[model samples]
Target: MSRKTLLRAGPLWQGGVSPYGLIEDPGAGGLALPAGFGGRVVARSGRKVAGLTWHAAPDGGACFPDGTGWIYVSNSALPLVGGASALRFRADGSIGDAYRILSGTELNRAGGATPWHTWLSCELGHRGRVFECDPYGTRAARPRLAMGRFKHEAAACDPDRQVVYLTEGERDGCFYRFRPGDWGDLTEGALEVLCASGGWEPVPSPAALLKGTRHQVRGARRFDGGDACHYTGGVCFFTTRGDGVLWAYDARTSALERVCDGVLAITSAPSGDLYVATREARVDVITPERAVAPFLRLDRPSGAELTGLAFAPGGGRLYFSARRGRTGGETFEVAGPFRGAWAR
Candidate 1:
């Protein structure tokens, strides 16, 4: 069956009744957040937090629950020195530990968290690859070479389907899915590209020895600057930064639809609301009712882009980063009642 592609148009966010009240002016750390919400710097480039120095060019990030508190992993996007670091938070929201998880990677960008508690840190470039990282800093990070080598952006693992959906960062990139030889194992897999004629086709060579993975498969649908992906409720959502379009792929029917426009990175709250970071230094929310509204905004550091949106366990605080800020790369946390119901 052929898939339906929907197109939408609008500003950063459409008006609607937001669960959170009006956003306050730039407060601490130049953050304009909803009432009852406050922001603080968790880490800054070249700065030390909880004794461990934070990584530079903070990109993709995610939170993992520990015994009583949680762990937040952030990726570094520097070419040669790029790696991933983690920060452990106590139950009282205090830093307990900080350390590096993955090291010696290149241009690490936005990545997704695996259901098995691993962080899929993606490298950005023609020779980019995906590295599976242990957020707890116990096991060693491994490179999943079978996932295909290309300019990777974000990855979304569908545990039910036993497959991992990935987005490429090229101007003419292809959405891909990798089916590992076995569930919970990334040792080997078959890389398939989404075809415009419907269904998926396996790429002849994932290594791209002579041809790029996106160009290896014929009739493959090309996404403009694919970035930021999330899978939930049998739907895989991804974004294309080039055209500023958000897409939803239905796993059951293999159908694709345009959800909205103008967003970069996205993360879902415990209330099932989607929070998207915008290029204009703002974060917006799409309610379960499909209503869109502004959630938070960053005031200073004009031209800085927002990314790495993640929520800590219990949904009490949200963490994100500005890859390029006025002072430098900075990761922040916004604490509020994110698990509350939407306004009627």
Candidate 2:
């Protein structure tokens, strides 16, 4: 008895535009889609362009296999001049061709996508760093710095154990796992900083009690943000906002489990299931024993804030991203079959 799909509230573009990007709903029951659904912007951010402002801070977006559309802006506050840029959208959403990649690094925001496809860009700034572009934009993008560069916010890869799952966008954040030893090669890794020794029950603070403490960020560092995914057995989830916990770094025994608390932005479900986005705008579904509940409920207008999330491979559809006051952002599409259905 698992079948309840109904989510359709399309087209709503206010002054700030709104919608960061999210996907899921290639067809049947995963349901979710918003972020240029059919496209048609071609390109934007006019005016002399220093970093192409409208305030600039578009934050994480991806969709390709041939559909083409990639976005990642940053300049919420930095040396600006490409503190973090990378835009390319054309499925009609317009805006194409803009690649600075990573500059002085300050706000970069949500980034992840690497089964070897490259594009890890993170930097929420306090001392954040995590760059690895190459989605065809040539090369020259550095900073793995052994992976301990702080403030980074979303990264996940595990091509059968190549391993990489990092998220720390501070408010007391820490949850990492990098095992390059020779796996898929991210230079040559062995960076592990996750430590929640026993099973569960921690959450005291100091960044969720720093799970097991083995951290390392001497010298160069900035913003240890959050937002990550790579579920199922190899496990590698992420999300942190002082108390919105949802860690889970287990590449087998690297350990760091906080399972699911509050949640803020996580994506998965080609059947793997695990879609969370909640500052309370809702969107939850964790279960497999962990238990969560509510699946989708977004009306937003009051304060408005819903970061990125994706899952559009061949399921019901679920994609998200939005921002409303502080600088006003945009990206939306929501069509789902959401509301609890897990029994595997």
Best by TM-score: 1
> How well is each residue in 191-267 modelled by candidate 1, as lDDT tens digits?
99999987999999999999999999889999999999988777788999899988888888898888887889898
Q: What is the C-alpha lDDT profile of model 2 across 33-100, one tens digit per residue?
A: 44333311222233223244333445554433325443433323222432444445444334556656
lDDT, candidate 2, at 64: 30
* TM-score of each model, paired residue for residue: 0.94, 0.28
lDDT at 293, model 1: 83
Off by over 4 Å in 2: 1-57, 60-105, 111-126, 129-149, 154-193, 196-236, 239-273, 276-307, 310-330, 340-344
Q: RMSD in Å for candidate 2, one decimal?
A: 18.0
The number of clashing residue pairs in model 1 is 0
Pick out the ten consecutive residues of candidate 2 with the lowest summed lDDT.
1-10
